[model samples]
Target: MSGTLGPAPGRIAYAELDVFAAYGSFLVQDDTARPDTSRAFITDLMNNLVATTDGAISVGTARRRILPVTLDVRTEAPEDNLDDWDHVTEAGLRITSGRLVVSTFDYRTAIPRTTVPPGDYTARTYASGFDTISDDRIHGDDAYRVILWPGPTVEPRVLKRYPHLPIPG
Candidate 1:
């Protein structure tokens, strides 16, 4: 995920990664080689995961799997909601218990520079999901305008399994 962060109400972009290892991840600031400006942090939960910025004139380019990792076409839209809000499976997967491992790399070198291991982050699920990423938060901090995009599923898996299984004699 690549984007630019502007002044107050800065955009915080994030990419959800579902990979085996954290070998390739990076962040570039101002389109220049700003050492240490890049960082990697994972959320304890899968909800509301984000990449933070300092609300400055900076550009960030991240390489990894984006959010909304999987969408159930059959159940894409929830019944409770009537606006066709897409349902994300992974979000609920870790909500109960799990962590979203994030690895941030240096944009200049495009190499894994930092690894935000499990249990170091707190992912917050937005009420509007991807659509509300840009909306300002009501409470505490509102300096950031988040933008989230669900990148193509990596190694897509079967989210829902059939209930019927014939017993083999």
Candidate 2:
């Protein structure tokens, strides 16, 4: 019984070639992979390192702009994004409860449409806790946060919602 971040999954760690290609970026000895046992070992080693890095990329969103359309479509209520689509990662422990505040985010991605050769548009809006996330990550005496608009929906959705759990009653 094993999985990621724990005991090895299984015997004979089989892997795909693309995994090797992906980790090739971290190689120090350029063009040094010989076609033998060494190749498989190097690929797996590089992939392991790539999985540990924390770098990430995000796209920005803009204000919603209603567009004139032929087909009829109405906005529907979306579920509260308390998980993945938005990030709610915590790193440290706190000893107190804080204020609660919620914010909204809008996402729009417009490009060439498939049917409409010369027209395309996209828009979305949702509540988030970006501020809560930022505040939680702060480990300093003087803590503060500035609101950011048109940011990636997942980046700053929650700010300070979940306060520290109280002692057992």
Root-mean-square deviation of Cα positions for candidate 1 versus the true structure, in angstroms: 17.7
lDDT of each candidate versus the true structure: 0.22, 0.18
Among all windows of 10 consecutive residues in model 2, the one with the lowest summed lDDT is 50-59
**Model 1 Cα lDDT, one tens digit per residue, 89-149:** 1121111122122223324344222221212112211212322332232222111111222
Off by over 4 Å in 2: 1-58, 61-74, 88-111, 114-169
Q: What is the C-alpha RMSD of each candidate to the true structure, in Å?
A: 17.7, 23.2
Q: Which runs in model 1 stand beyond 4 Å of their true positions?
A: 1-29, 32-41, 44-46, 55-104, 109-169
